[model samples]
Structure formats: structure tokens, C-alpha cells
Target: MGRAIVATAALSALLAVCGCTVQGTDADGKHHLPVRIELPGAKASPSATASTPGTPSAAPAANVLWSRGDSGSGVRELQARLRQADWLFDGPTGTYDDLTEQAVAGFQGKRGLPKTGETDKVTWQRLVKMTHEPGKWDLYLMGGQPAGAPDPRCLTGRVLCIDKTTRTLRWMIDGRTVSTMSVRFGAQYTPTRDGVFHVYWKARNWVSTLYNSPMPYAMFFSGGQAVHYSYDFSARGYAGGSHGCVNVRDEAAIASLFAQVRTGDKVVVHR
Candidate 1:
């Protein structure tokens, strides 16, 4: 029994040196010693590896400065700059509309931008770099200038009080200004006659048989001179002059004025 104990102790010491542990006797009545092996410098398994925090991400969208349906002096400034670039042709109307949206998109596309039709910060910066600051008349190139005081001849009755110097037209009733807009007159050679007249005729959607051009919302005050909405005037703003009639650039304003005006309304065209 002493010798058997000595052998078992020797086996135990050997097993411990080998990093082995005896689990239990197998079916063969032999002790099963499983050795736990460890590598010198092995990498950790995927499951045993420690987890790390995720990396940060950038913003999903760019910063927007202006977009469709936005309006104010900012929009006017934008439009005026766009006009300088020849990307826009209408009023700085101080109201962002479809035309403004299209203009912005076109400008963005020309600059290799995302062309989202929204004026983003980067896009605005690029535009500012390419264009200069707009002047006062540039902002009001297509009208919206302040109207002048009504003449004494226009105060008493319903009158289309037009001031050549101010380049404005005021619709007045009983000495009260009802509505006002910007107006352009004929060229130097064919100047708009300054006189007190009456609207003798009105023709909606009229094509001038003499000039072969469209004269929408025409209110004839003289023989062939009328107050009318001119698409040319709207598109080219003060860059060109009319033949003999008064040209209105704002079509909507002129349309509204056309609806209110009637035959025999006083028309005072003055300097």
C-alpha cells in the first residue's frame, strides 16, 4: 500500500507539471487526464475579443440658407445677383416663386452643385464669390420702386396717374391712392404723349395688328397709345423701350388694374 501511494503521488506530480486534470475513469477503467494547452503569443478569438465603440459620422445634409417660398430683402438680393449673372430675367419681387426656384437650380447646376434648387450655405458662398453686390436699381429692375406723389390733375376723380420722372403708375380714386406699380414709356424718338385723356377702349388678349405683337390687358387712352402689360418689358426691364404705349412689367398687377379700370377713367400721363 505504501508503494502504491508513492506511484499515485508521482503520477499526480507529473500531471500537475503537464497542466492536466483527471476528470474521471473512462469505460476502460483508465483515468482520463485532459491537458489544457496554451500558445505562447496567439491572437484572441473573435468571440473572446473586446468590443470597441463605433466611429462618429458626419451630418446627413448640407446647411440651407434659402429655398423656395422664402422671401424678403434676402431674396431680392439673391435675384439681383442672379440677374447680374444672367440667370434671372424677372423682378426681384421680394417674393420667392417658381421662377426664383428655377433660377436657383440653374445657377447651382452651372456651378457643379447638387442642384437641389435650394440655396445652401456652400452654394451661397460660391455665388457670392462669383457675383458682386447689387445696386438699388438692380434690385428694383423689374419695378416695385416707390411711386411719386399724385399730380393735381389726378386727385379729383378715378385716374391712372402716371409720373414719367418717378417711373411709377398710381391708380387713384377720389384723391386716394388705391394701387401703384412701375411703368416704362416709349423711346426718345416716339415719346409717350403727356396729357390728360380718357380710356376709350379696352381689349383683353389683343394682338397689335400694326406691330404684329401681343399687347395684353390693353386700355387705350389715345388713338394707338395704351396702358398695357408687355412681356418684353417684363423680360428685359428698362433695357428696352416701347413704341408709343406705356409698358407695365408686372403682369399680375396690370391684370388686377385692368379688371378695375373702365372706359372714361381719367388717364393723366405727366413728367
Candidate 2:
């Protein structure tokens, strides 16, 4: 009996080492040992599937209405309108490039539309109307001049109206308005004030000392108001909308305006 008990104890110890435990006996009076199976270095399944490194997860493709460079009258017309509206550059040369894509995205973002960078019917319609009639002002109100006002000079060679309402800067040569282009402005909290001012100074690729904003063509007009290029051209003029600075849309427009306007150019702002 003592030898039998020792043998049973030894068997139980061996089973424990092997991760096996004695369970309740079956109806046939046979002892059952349950095995605790384990896989070496096994990892549990993740709650979510791991995404591919550096690759964004699959997202539903945006509904594209217009193809890039679809040779058609409609496409050409849309491209032309976009160019005129300053939503695109170099007027629809029948070639779609990075500039065109960017302009489309900008237009879509401005109108509170989908930013698919595709010229759809809706986008086309908006561009056409906007380009045709850039400004919709019944009255152009000039702000009151402060005490000891200096003599206002008329630098009328090429006058550019940085419209606060349409978020566009229009160029007028010899009192004849030539072209207008869209522009971004300051935040809703801090906007470009309305008043008659002049281009006091010029700075190429000027960065703001107050904010993280980059002004490519800095044409200083008022105390802080200037005509400059901004990344946020999504807000095309609706209100007194700039950080006391008139913001233009693209680099091309900025360059053009800067080249035309010199130091002490007349910058008239009105309602």
C-alpha cells in the first residue's frame, strides 16, 4: 500500500509538470486528467486589424464628376471660368496640372462644397457666376480719415482693389478693370478692417511677427493691412475678413500685383 501511494504521488507530480491535472472520474470509474494546452510565443488576435505601415486605411473614393484634362467644350469652359475666378492658374491650356487640382480644391473648399478637386456641375456653375460678377457692392463706403491726415496720392497706373466682400483682388489699368482673382483672408475673430489706405512698404516673402502666417508678397497699406498670399484662401471675401491685412489667393496673383504696385500706391478700402 505504501509503495502504491508513492507511485500515485510521483505520477501526480509528473502530470503537474506537464500541465495536466486530475479531473472528476467518468461514469466508467476511470480517472480523467485534463490538459492545459499552450502554444509557444503565441499572440492573441488584435481587436482591430493592423493597418499597413505608412499606408492609410482604405477609404471610400470620392465621387468624381470631371476627369483631369477631359477634352471637351464643357471641361474647357469650366477650366476657363476657374482661371478667371483665380481658382486656377494660366487659363485652361487644355492641360490639367498641380495648379489646376489645387485651384479646384480651393474652390470646393470655399463654397462649402466637397473638396474632391473635380469640376462637377455644381462647381462649374459657381465658378461661372463668380467669375462673371466678382463684386456685388451697391455702395463703396470710405472710412473717415484720422486727425492730421496726409495727402493721399493716386498711384493709378495699375490699381488693384483687394475686395473684402468677394475675397478677390481686382486689377484696373487706366480706370478699366482688367482681371480679378480670389483670395483668403484673416480669421473670423480678427479680420481686415475697412478703410482707405495706401501701399506704404513692400516685402518679398515676408513672415508675420505676430502669427504663424506667411505673406509671400507683403504690400503694407494701413497700420497692419497688406496685400499678401495666404494658405487659407478658402474664405473668399464675405465680411471685414482679414487680420488687418488684405489677403490674396495664389502666388501668381501676388507676384503680379506686387510687380504692378510700388511703394506708396493708393489702396482704397470700402464697404
Candidate 3:
């Protein structure tokens, strides 16, 4: 009996190493014990609900979407569309990085879709219709330049000259453009107001009283609208919106702008 017990334990250890399971040893009698084993490279029998012979088992992706970290032409196309909308600052790099995600989320918000920085079927379709199919140069940004012609109003004194057509914000000092950056506007409903305005307020770390969202480095120009840093803009890129305020994605740029801009600097938001 002692020999048998030692043999059983040793066999069990051996079976474990061999990837085999011992069964029906409830009574500890080796005579009635059963073992089930599967050899390497052997496959289990399919169930009745399995696919028919000669048919492909994997389903084609129907809801295929692109988000951050993915790479390919899809991401390139997404970047092009966003550039057309002035949401994507850089040219397409063929990889869906954080900037791509930001652009997608901003676009989604403008269209009143869920602010999930992903390129779903619906988002793709809408973007395709709205933006021109990008040429090779457009995607790669071989020669893309910011709008140079500032409005006459922006030529004198200190001014934040923003142009929707150019998709640029030119920081002007004494009739000369000092700085420029890619910018985006609000949705059709909550459009960033156009025309000349003045900075009425400045909040270094402002939270929206209405939207309950952060508006850091805010320089208020029109009513509740302000020029501020948006992490949504920074993280998601052009894929988000402000509540009628100018959304600057670059945190460092906005921080500098917030500091330099006075309480009544000229803000010209124009076409």
C-alpha cells in the first residue's frame, strides 16, 4: 500500500509535467482511475454550431474604426480631413497618434456626435463629404503655409488676429505679426463670434460656469467666449470644441498669450 501511494503521487507529478490530467481517482484506487490526454498539435472536435466546411471562420470587420496608436492610410486620410477643417495642425504621419485622436474628437463634437476621439463609420462618411480628398502633398504637407494676409484691423497695436479662412491666429505687435498658430472654431450652433472685440477678463485657471469644463489660461474677449488652452484640444487635437470661445490646443502657446495679452487688447475674429 505504501509503494502504491508513492507511485500514485509520482505518476501525478509526471502527468502534470506532461500536460495530462488524471480523473476518476475519487476512491484512490488505481485500478478504476482514468486519464484523459491530448497530444500536441491535435485539435478538438467542432460543435454542431461551428462553421460549415470550406467556409471562412473569421468574420470581416464591419465596424472598423481608427483611434490613437493605429497606423495606415486610414489614419492619413483622417489627418487630411482634419487639416481641411483646421483641426489637425501637422500633416498626416500615417500613424494614428494622440494628435489624430484629438482632431477626431473635436470634429465629432462639432457635428454633435459623441466626443469619443475615434473615427467610426459615421464620422468617416461625414468627413469624406465635408473635406476634399487630400492630394499627396496635402497629406504630407510639403508646402502648407498659414494664412499670411492679416485683416487691416490687425495691422496696428497689439491684436489677436484670427482668421477662419487661414485657420491661423496671428499675434500682432505694432503692425507686425509676431506669432502664429493653427486654430479651430466652434460648431455651427455655438459659433465663435466674429468681428472686433476686447479682452474683458483674464483667468489663469478658469472653469466654465455653464459647461463645467476647464478653460485654462483664458483671455475672455466676447461675453463668455475667450482664448484659452484646451487639453481636449491638446490631447485630442482638433477633435473638440469650446463654448463659443477660441480653443487653442497648444498649452505653452496659450500660456504665453495669456501672459502677454492685457485686459483690453484687440481681438479680431474674422473670415
Q: Largest lDDT belongs to which candidate?
A: 1
Between candidates 1 and 3, the one scoring higher on lDDT is 1
Name the candidate, 2 or 3, with the larger TM-score value. Answer: 3
Q: Model 2: which ten-residue window has the lowest total lDDT?
A: 138-147
Question: Model 3 reaches what TM-score against the true structure?
Answer: 0.52
Write the residue-wise lDDT of candidate 3 on 121-161 in tens digits.
99899999998988654664422235769999998889999
Clashes by residue pair, model 2: 165-237, 167-237, 186-242, 191-242, 192-242
Task: Quantify all predictions' global Cα lDDT against the true fold.
Answer: 0.86, 0.60, 0.78
Q: Using Cα atoms with residue i matched to residue i, what is each candidate's TM-score against the true structure?
A: 0.60, 0.42, 0.52
What is the C-alpha lDDT profile of model 2 across 83-145, one tens digit per residue? Answer: 567665544444565677778989899989988787777877777677763222211111111
Off by over 4 Å in 1: 1-65, 97-102, 112-122, 200-209, 234-239, 249-264
For residue 70, model 3's alpha carbon misses the true position, in angstroms, by 19
How many backbone clashes does every candidate have? 0, 5, 7
Report the candidate with higher TM-score, 1 versus 3: 1
Pick by TM-score: 1 or 2, better one: 1
Worst-scoring 10-residue span by lDDT in model 1 = 43-52
The candidates, ranked best first by lDDT, are: 1, 3, 2
lDDT, model 3, position 175 = 86
